[model samples]
Target: MATAATSRGFTMPFNLRLRRADVATLNDKNGVLEMRRKKRRLLTSDWGVVKCCCSDSVVPIRMATGSGNNVEKCEDWRFDMKKSQNSQVVRAPAMRFASPQPRFISKQDKFFPRCSPRNSGPQSRDSPPKRDTGIANEKDWGISLLNENVNESGTNEDGSTWYRESGEDLGENGYRCRWTRMGGQSNDGTSEWKETWWEKSDWTGYKELGVEKSGRNAEGDSWWETWREVLHQDEWSNLARIERSAQKQAKSGTENAGWYENWWEKYDAKGWTEKGAHKYGRLNEQSWWEKWGEHYDGRGSVLKWTDKWAETELGTKWGDKWEEKFFAGIGSRQGETWHVSPRGERWSRTWGEEHFGNSKVHKYGKSTTGESWDIVVDEETYYEADPHYGWADVVGDSTQLLSIQPRERPHGIYPSLDFGSTPPTDEPPDESSTSQ
Candidate 1:
């Protein structure tokens, strides 16, 4: 290794080599050019310069051929040893080399193999094995074991909380009512004591008496003292009779038959009379049933207007009281029978024209009369008759019948009162007037 410093302030180590032919030129007068294996050239300078006598020496020569040839090759070569002394030596650049560190296997990785189901046997340490007990040995199981022991000990029979002492078994009820301690005192009180019978209603009275035998009294027997004595055969019979009377009364008033008997007997008793119908003047002036019946009957009357006679003769007042009352309001005159007016002359004429033709009168007595003898007329007929006796009497046969023939009238042509268009303009010339 060779170390040298450069002018650039860096030191480096490098290898050096010299050529065999340049060994003799090692003297310090002139510098030697050393060439090695066609790679690089190294120069060493000499301190001295030789003055030659021959001109050939002035011109340096280099051999161009042959392997053994050795000649100095230079062109105007000059050397300064003093300057060379100060020149720094050159060395090749240094390089840092690095590589990844090698790795070794750890102990844990080497000793323990990878876990796989195919390579390893079943796990023995992970979970404990399940045990099987015989069916007869049910005591080894969890909840089932406890239940079996409880059954065998007969604890479940009288309820789990109950326990009987030795030589003291459960009663016929399979339950213990009382528990006795080994040396406990007897239930009977010590020293003098008295016996007393009590009536529950008179607790203080019974307590004051030292001993008294209670017997049936006029007021009533106490239920707590003697329940059997309180209710006798006669008392039961009286209750039965009262219940029968109530049921009989309920059946009479309800239209529902016996359907509402229970509800009526229970809630409706106070509001009902002895006859069991709801009382009048209680919630209202009359019973609801009476009002309901009235409404039902009125509804039937309303439907009666659909009758054909009412619809045609009476118009909309068919089943109502309007037509009859109107007829009655028109008082009779002289010996003539009264008649009811049609709603109005316009209404009468419209209705009449719809049922009858325009013919005023004919041999058949007005074309408007149906086979049933009901009068019918047209707008012209009603207008002609309206001024005479009103439309009412005009349509009524009792007041004025239809003429057998057309007639003449003071107001143009009109239905006849007798046979012609007029009401007899010449009254047959009175007999007295003719004689005079």
Candidate 2:
């Protein structure tokens, strides 16, 4: 292994994994072209220069490293050429390699931008570019994802340092979570522990805690204490706002009636909110939701959104003050919403084009709201047990920062549970010590 430090102060390792022919190909065409072959672990600079002594035009060749670790390390490099006595000499462009260190999105980063930069730049390899932090139009808010089993660094106002750890286990049902506000000064911050309590039956009908980190509370529990605490918080809480929900769903089936249920609540000093739905009807491409929700505020305002997929009717009511019924007729399979102003005024709106999948993940949306002033009105789904339990990003109008709910692994140690028929042991048999 060869380690070299770039001018950028980053250390990159060069492994001699290529065969003699391979290294020979990598030789500086300008220098002595000597080649060697070994294990194929060698990596070429994104642009491996092949100099031609003769001339018409000298071109620099580039290659993508799809093996082992070079996946993300490969990047763009420029090659500068000069013609002397009609002979072309290649001088590769200075490369700007992003630090190998992981680029993280803090709990404070509201700008998660897409990998496609708002402005284009030079690229070396063919692999897709990494997401750019939200500096432009797109939000690459992917704080929920990390390379398997890595930890995050965080701090508190008291100048306390916290370490965030994450991972998952798959058995009867996949389980995962993240612990936030943990490992600060004196380990004083609260650790919100969430583990999906799934009733694993080889048979269908599996239920899970849908919301991230909703199960078992962790150390320093200051947030919502009960289901009502979830409903009382008006604003979205780090783990509060009672947005935390539990989900249960029937197995996937084609042409059969598959159903799912999601119940969640939120509360604060002023009032409380509750949302739940049991949507079951055809499976595969034709599934829908039987959604219902109600809210009671101390301020005397009531809200409810319901849907009876059987009759294909979507209903809405605001404290007996205003109500609406949305139905697919004249060929519109959409829903509707209405509101009653505090001043005894009524306003209504309707939408069509129904699309549902996995109890969540909306494909498109209809018009906005006027009476409620909700810029975006939407109806989506949530499930109890999902493979996406730990990695999926929130996809609504929510702007609150979501922490990685913690797991139940031994403190300060990270290890994955292999769910295969034969679980992995601490060590595999040493071939050198085995009998002949």
lDDT for each candidate structure = 0.15, 0.25
* Candidate 2 global CA lDDT score: 0.25
Q: Top TM-score: which candidate number?
A: 2
Q: Highest lDDT among the candidates is held by which one?
A: 2
Tens-digit lDDT string for candidate 2 (168-258) = 4444322332222212232333322222111111111111122222211122212111110111111122112323443333222122323
Distance from true location, Cα of 151 in model 2, Å: 20
